[model samples]
Every structure is written in structure tokens, then in C-alpha cells.
Target: MESVGITIRLFGAFRKFGNGSEIEISVRCGTNLKELRVLLSQYLRENDPKFSETLVVDSAIANDTKILTNDFCIEKSCTLAILPPVCGG
Candidate 1:
């Protein structure tokens, strides 16, 4: 299987779901962001339930200005920003 490197950066409350900083995950080339979430849940479930829930509900995995790969294919060496819903002004 062709593989690509993905760096997931979690912000705000979502950060608690990960091991701090960024996580480098290997994904099959053409994997979608939704698929990426499933992969993350496998790892995040061990640490925080809230992270999994938030990832399902509030986060959007995007590539720069365009929100490609929400269900589209992911490219090699792409960076997905895990943005959770923000509260407060």
C-alpha cells in the first residue's frame, strides 16, 4: 500500500486528546480526513474520551484554505489542523 505522512495538530481542548505537540501518522495515500479520524480514535481512545467525541462533532480536518479531504483523498506529507469548536470571546 502506498503510504503518506500526516501531521495532526490539535488546538484548544482538542490538545488534551493527543500526546502534546503534533502526531505523525502514516496513512495510505488517498485516505480521506474522515478515515484519518477513525485512525486517530484508535489511539486517542486510550487517553481521553472527550477528544474522540469532540473530533466527531466539532473538529474539521482541513488543508490550508481549502477543506479538501473532508471526504476527499489525502495527499502525501499533508498537514491536517484539528480545529475544535471555540467558546468565549
Candidate 2:
């Protein structure tokens, strides 16, 4: 299976994954947000001992324009942002 590299900009708690704010992840072609989330969560768990599964479940994935639904399929390599749930009062 062919795969593409996707660059995801980390936000909130996700920034703790590495020294940089962005990380490149490779996914099989035609992967969607739901699948990507699982892959990312696994990657995080492997890379960071403090990673939590709920973070990926609660986060939102957005392209240059808007937040994408889990069913949205990514066909090409691109830069996207993962915005973790935010709370402000």
C-alpha cells in the first residue's frame, strides 16, 4: 500500500509530543480523519509516555480552510492542524 506524509500542527496538549510544534506522519492513501486519529494517538503513545487516548478523540482536524469530519478522506500529502479541545471562561 502506498502512503503519503502529512504534516500536522499540534495545539494545546498535543504540543508536548516533541520539541517542534509540527510532526510529519505517514498514512496510507485514502486515509480519513478517524483512522488518522488512531494512528496519531498510537504514535503519541509510543513517543510520549504521558499521551492520552481521549485527547485524539476530543480533538479536531482542520485543513487550511475548515475543520474536517472523520469521514473526510485525505488523498494527498498536505499540512493540517490538530486543535485539541479548548476551554476558556
Q: What C-alpha lDDT do the candidate models reach, one value each? A: 0.71, 0.89
Question: Best lDDT goes to which candidate?
Answer: 2
Question: Which residue pairs collide, candidate 2?
Answer: none
lDDT per residue as tens, model 1, 1-89: 89988888777766665577667788899887678778877767766654446555567776667555467778678787777666768
What digit string (tens of lDDT, one per residue) describes model 2 on residues 1-89? 88999999988788877666899989999998999999998899999778789988889999889989999988999999999888879
* lDDT over C-alpha atoms for residue 64 of model 1: 63
Using all chains and alpha carbons, the TM-scores for the candidates as numbered come to 0.76, 0.91
lDDT of 1 at 12: 76
Model 1 clashing residue pairs (backbone): none
lDDT of candidate 1 at residue 24, scale 0 to 100: 77
- Report how far off residue 75 is in candidate 2 (Å): 0.6
lDDT for 86 (candidate 1): 60
lDDT of 1: 0.71
Ten-residue region with minimum lDDT total, candidate 2: 11-20
Runs of candidate 1 exceeding 4 Å displacement: 17-19, 49-51
**Model 1 clashes, total count:** 0
